[model samples]
Target: MSILVTGATGTVGSLVVQRLAQQGAEVKALVRTPAKAALPAGVTAVPGDLTDVASLRRALTSVRTLFLLNAVVPDELTQALVMLNLARDAGVQGIVYLSVIHADLYSNVPHFTGKHSVERMIERFELPATVLRPAYFMQNDLQARGAIEGHGVYPMPLGSAGVAMIDVRDIADIAASELLRRHWAADPLPRLTLDLAGPDALTAASVAALWSEALQREVRPAGDDLESFEQQWAHFAPGWMAYDMRLMMAAIQQHGMKPAEGSVQRLETLLGRPLRRYRDMVRESGQLKLG
Candidate 1:
């Protein structure tokens, strides 16, 4: 089975490509630049831009399964729709969409709304798809490693409230399974929607404690004001991204990031093992920084 992975050079998409290739699958990485794809051996890097439907036609050629991960761009919805149309036309059998957790609940966020819009299109088109709503990535904390190591503080906007953040590794494994697993019966399995998270529901304070233990330093918990956070983030990122993230963080602050009961266990079942906790992520952060 020939599988094509979009956003192949990204955090989650790259891992999916590696997992599929390691499983002995015929993998095609649909990236904008094949020379810079940096994919594993045996994985074919096919140059293609999702924004250009014509380019997608060449990449989707003979691709039976597709792993779709739309970047957080202003034209995300348009790009996703174009890819969906091309995939449908190319006779791609299955699609595994990498979507944000709580996208349905927090549809007001622009990026989440964009993903939801594409999801609606996928359902409306009656495509064979599996939607993976993965929680906030543990890798996001790496951005604040400097603060943890130097300033000795955790500075996320999330307050004392707990969120069920997950590891990208788990997301990649589950996505690969959904994309490559074959059905036993003649009838194809129904389209599935999974809410994925880590083993523990962690708060900002708890995260600080983990960092302190891992780094053997006093990493204090520092609550962030949303307004300041947005202002600071906007300076570095796009205005819309800062605004969208601000709104999402506000929602999380108001309504805690706690997952539904049994959600963790269900995710573990799909992962085929226990999910990684914040401490585990902290322990691995040092290695991640070097990479």
Candidate 2:
């Protein structure tokens, strides 16, 4: 069965493509630019856009499984609905959707709210699907790597709250498992929804301490104020995007992303191994250079 993976160039999607291809699965990657996709040798790169229904139809040909991953855009709901309808029309048998944790609880956050809408769409269609709602990405710290390395500070707006963040790689592993697991034509289809998180729930200060120990520098939490976070992103992001990010962060600061019971254990069972620790990710990435 050929699996069509959308958002194939993104962090999680790219890793999923690589994992599926390495496992000898026939993987088709949907990308805006096939020339720049740079997927593995055996993986097929199909040029398509979620907004372009015609293009998606062309890409979905002979595709049995679909990994639907959409970016967080203002029109995310529209794009996802268009893609979902197209995928169903194309006779795609199974789908694996990447979503955020607590999407229902944080409806005000545009990203979470958008994902919640898509989740409902999948359920309404009654598709043979597995929905993965992963907690915060550990790799998000890479955006603030410069601040941690140069200024020795963790400058996120996550206040004193703890988050059970998971690595994007683990999320990819789970997605691949769903797409690649063997199922006969007569076998019962599994409709699953899983919430994934890391083994440890770490706060901002705890993360800073990890960086400090890893880099041999006194890294500390820069501040917990939303205004400072807004200012930091505003310098590079559009005004509305900066505000959107601030809104999301403020919610996290106020109500931490604590995982439900058995979330980590379930993730580990899916991955067939222990979840990757934040400190281990930093060490293996070779980003912990001493200053």
Candidate 3:
């Protein structure tokens, strides 16, 4: 069974594509630009957009399984809904959806709500699926290296509550495994949801301390000045995306992306290893600039 990976050019999607290819799975990547997709040698790049029905229809040809990882955008839900309907029409046997942790709990956040809506569609349509709810990507902190290394500060609004940030590599591995499991099963498997989290529940202070130890200097939290976060993103991202991020941060402030009981044990058992740690991620990523 061939697998169709939506958002295959994105951060986690791209990683999943690589893992699937390494496992010798037949992989098809749905991307806007086939010419520029730069996929693995055996992976086929199918030119398509989530909003374009005709394009998606063509991409779904002969695809038995789907990996849906929609980006955060103004029309995210519309894109996901259209893709799900098309996947059903094409007789997609199974789906692996990448949704946010605490998606339902963070009700007011647009992106979180959008993902929850996708999950509902998967359930309502009775699609055989595995939903992966991952916390904040630890690699996203790499983007703040300049702030941490140069200015001695952790710029993200991690708040007093702690988040168990997961590694993208682990997520990709689990996604690939699930895709193959669904593809190989003779009988239709029941729906499952997994909360992907790291080994430690880290707060702003803890994150700052890690940076301090890494860089061999004093580092402080930027505090939860959400307006500044919004302002910073507004300059780079579209207005709606920026506002959506602010809402996410606000929700994080009130309720951390804490995983359910045995979440760590479950992930560790699946991988046969301990979940990746924030300190290890920082060290391995070469974030430390020796003074």
Candidate 4:
């Protein structure tokens, strides 16, 4: 009766592992290198990769619940399909998949399309799973610390449609809760999707203003220039991945990442607490000295 977490060394995956451990769940982390994976003391680290079938089979053995997370790689869809197929064969009781918000709407983006396809497969095959479609991760802004701190600018072209930027910490909390629910349930759970979003639907201009208020310095949005944003990120990420993200930004511009009606309230009711705000997380993250 153990829960297995893939991408255990990664951002959200790592946080989810910590959360499950704090809740005292029997957690197993699937990592490439178990010796090097810096997981909690009691959490078991299993060596496996999505592409390696034998390793995955070994990892899935005796595990009742799974947190399926895959990075935005070239073989993302392939990896997800393979893992899902394997999960089915292994009779894994419950699965929690980390998907993007508006995955069905943003069909142009590679990762989004992959997730949409995965969602359909889950439904078509009737996998006992919960898909968590999270909004723009507020921590993504942390990467722009150089721009915000060094220059007085927020460079992301989050567009005018407004994104309800969600906090990663809250995502982990909800993910762990779902994992625990599925783990402890006597019967198998049905397929469900949760739209994880923040309280405020923030615009680029408003985000700049929030930074200004928090840092006590004038911070400005770099404007919704998709090409420049892509070019700038191209230097850091793969060229195709950067372009993929630019397309995603365009979709966000056209169709905001706002949650469905009462999704935020539903999430709040589930957690028995308000969803974390973008502004408050910034202050607590210790990324910047609050003014």
By TM-score rank, best first, the candidates go 4, 3, 2, 1
lDDT tens digits by residue: candidate 3, 1-291: 699999898889999999999989899999898998889989999988998999999999998999998888789999989988988999888889999899999999999999999899889978899999999999999999889988998999989788999999999988998999998788668999999989888889999998888888899999999999999989989888899999998988889888999999998888888878888888887856532
For 145-185, candidate 1 gives per-residue lDDT tens digits of 88889899887878766788988898898998888773112
What are the lDDT figures for the candidates, one per model? 0.82, 0.85, 0.90, 0.92
Residue range with the least summed lDDT across 10 consecutive positions in model 4: 282-291
Question: 2 or 4: which has the higher lDDT?
Answer: 4
TM-score of each: 0.93, 0.94, 0.97, 0.98
> Which candidate tops TM-score?
4
RMSD (Cα, Å) for all candidates, in order, is: 2.8, 2.0, 1.6, 1.2
Best by lDDT: 4
* Candidates 3 and 4 compared by TM-score, better number: 4
lDDT of model 3, residue 257: 85
User: lDDT per residue, candidate 2, 1-291, as tens digits?
Assistant: 589999899999999999998889898999888998799999999998998888999998998888999887778889888888887898887888888888898878888888999899888878778888988899999888899989998998677777888999888998888888622234426678888789877889998988998888799998778887888899998777788888888878878787778888877877789999998888876766533
lDDT of 4 by residue, 18-83 (tens): 999999999999999988989997999999999999999999999999999999999999999999
RMSD of candidate 3 to true structure, Å = 1.6
